[model samples]
Target: MVKHTKKAVLLTLLTVNMIVVSACSTANTSNQSSAAPTNDAKATAGATGEKVTLTYGGWKLDTITEVIKAFQASHPNIEVKAENTPYKQYFTKLETSAQGGTMPDVLLMNGPNFIKYADNGMLKDITGNIKADQLDLNNFPASLVSLYSLNGKNYGIPKDYDTIGLWYNKKLFDEKGVAYPDASWDWNKLVEAAKKLTDTSKGIYGFAAPMMNQEDYYNTILQAGGNVISDDHKKSGYDQPEAIEGLKFLTDLIQVHKVSPTLAQMTETAPADMFTSGKLAMYFDGSWAAFTINQNQDMKNNADVAVLPKGKKQGVVIHGLGNVISANTKHPKEAWEFVKFLASKEAAEIAAKQGGAIPAYKGSETAWLSAFPQYHAKAFIDMTAYASPYPVSKNTSVWNTYETDILKNAWTGEKSVADAAKELGAKMNQALAAEK
Candidate 1:
């Protein structure tokens, strides 16, 4: 849920010089590309006599910029300009803008980071803006929308959602004489397939066990019947027997099983890159990675997805962000109108069809699936039945950053799992206490 596709997307958008953003739009927000106009366009002022110019901050500058331009087309009186920047730096920009007292009129807030901004009184309460009275709350997925709400107040609009699944190279399975992955597959089956597929002589491995919070590690945690964060979001369960055993699976792959490359080797050659280049046979990734995998010519033809092997409970990770209007927006009404329009059923459908991410609105992903046929993306559909939101707490960012780093060190064998878990638990408990 760390937007695993982002690094892959950015890598392509910057290095490959492809991943062309074909601007497409409806009567409302779209990805249509056009030159920004210097002149202000406005429709007749609704209740206020003033025309307004709105600014937005989002990592998807190209996509959002197009939507804003088209927004001006429909509401000719309101002009919206967006500053697009790299996803890695968008939060720093948001914080800097917040400090300057001029944060964008509409700010982007992901699930994990939203609690910090909303709880600190940096956001406007938009519960009234999005009324179950006006719109059907049923259109959006429950888990995704709930992630943006805290204590009955909605601070962000759920834009898109994605879940994790196992991506396999079909060619590898064929060469190894192993059956394709399916729901019947379990942990032992996966470990056995991994062993059969791994061949150091051929320089191919079965899995990539990078210690990321989401893709590999979180799935492992859930598979071991453990929660990454406690229900109350206080203290650390990182040291729990199940959680440590979950993490040990990865270390087992490298140190005990000798299938995956050591953590050092994985660091030098990132897992995503390795999987895309055919060096690895399988990977756990989000639906968004379809864009990157499909765009990569080498693996594009051979890649496919399957439901991940089950643990005590079948699990998948869901993640997305909500559209939030600034607490101090001069045109709060217009901003809300725009937010509703972007989050509307039509808008979500267009977003799904556009090939960027899956829309959280009900029934939108059907179109997204049709748009890409070769991958047989239904594993994602199957995942929705049991998917869980990425866990977040008051100080989620603080705790996870430390916990994941220590876990990574543990995976690489720099420290023992027991020792690392205790250290991680102590730091996480301290972070949670400070949040309290």
Candidate 2:
């Protein structure tokens, strides 16, 4: 079942500090020039043969291109200009745009950043628009819808969702004469398999246990019955015994058992790169990795996935990106039309067949599963039965900074897991408490 939060109180918790500029300012004059008709004027303008152009911004350039082409084919009067930004700089660009009142008419937002944007009055309240358009919310999971909502108003429509899985090198498993991981395998089973598969001489480790939150330790923490943040979003759970156990599990794989590469080794080669290069036997990764793996001829043939091995119980962290609109957009009607179309069954089918990630729309997963028939694609969808929402407080980015810096000590063995976790908890609590 998906969790829910009461409407977030509008708080002055801005993740990015920028000088606020009004929409009418000189900085946004160019933005205002591109404004199309208002919702009520849209139909009349269309009848008079007016053309509307919308600037759409996102990190998924390739996928967005395909989606835009499909959208424009049917709605010939609407033109969409794609603004692609690399993920590393995407948020920085977006915040800058928001500050200048030059944000895109339609923008893509991920779960953690959605609340930050919505609470800051940067996103449109699309509840009335959605109701007026009669777009079916039933197509998406309630939990997913909840993720894009704040204080009972919808700010975005979910585009895709992801869950973590154990991606393994099938050739390595066959060479080692070990059975591939299955539903029956637990944490102990995974460790035993990793030990058998590790080859120090070949510089190949059994696994890649990078200090990542979503794809690595978070699942273990949830499976171990630990929370990242309290249900009320008022406290941190890093210091909890189960949460610490989860962190230690991954750290031990590097520092003690040596079944995974150390932090220094991974710095030389990223875990994903190592896995793709056939230097790692097993890696915990997200469903989105399917597209990357499938693109690589060598890894595509050898890689397969399994449900994440059970910890104390089966668990995986789930998150997705949503399509949002700028609150200051002049073409509310055209923007809503585009967003509604993107959330429709037609768009979901196109995305599913692209094999980038699973569409959040219900019943569209079959296409995604069929996109790569050789791999165990069903494992990702099936694991959703025990998936946990990606943990976030109102000030997620602030606390996330604390998570990475403080947890690195434990990951690198500079500090004991208990000590590092205790410190992380204290700092994280301070960040959460600062949020309204």
Tens-place lDDT per residue, model 2, 1-436, is 1111211222223324322110000013223324423344445444466888888888766764677889999988889998988777777777666546677888888777776667756677899888887888988866678778888899999888888889999999999998999999898999999999999999888998998888898888988889898766789999899999989999999998899999888878889999999989998998888878999999898999999988888888888778998776767777888999989888888877765468888888998888778899889888866677677666687877888899999989999999999999999888887776
Task: RMSD for all candidates, in order, please.
Answer: 9.5, 6.2
| Cα lDDT listed for each candidate | 0.71, 0.79
Runs with alpha carbons beyond 4 Å of true place in candidate 2? 1-49
lDDT of 1 by residue, 1-436 (tens): 3343432332232222111111000000011012111111223253465677777777775644445555678887677777677776666656555544566767667777677666655566778656742766667777777778888888877887777888999999999899889889887788899999998898999987777677777777788888777766675778898878777877888888888888888889988898998999987887878888988989998899898887666766677767887665555667776787778777776666555577777777887888669987878766767777778776566776686678777887889887898798889888888775
Tell me how many residue pairs clash in candidate 1.
9
Estimate the lDDT of model 1.
Answer: 0.71
Task: List clash counts for every candidate, in order.
Answer: 9, 1
- The 10-residue segment with the lowest total lDDT in model 1: 20-29
As a whole number from 0 to 100, the lDDT of residue 354 in candidate 2 is 68
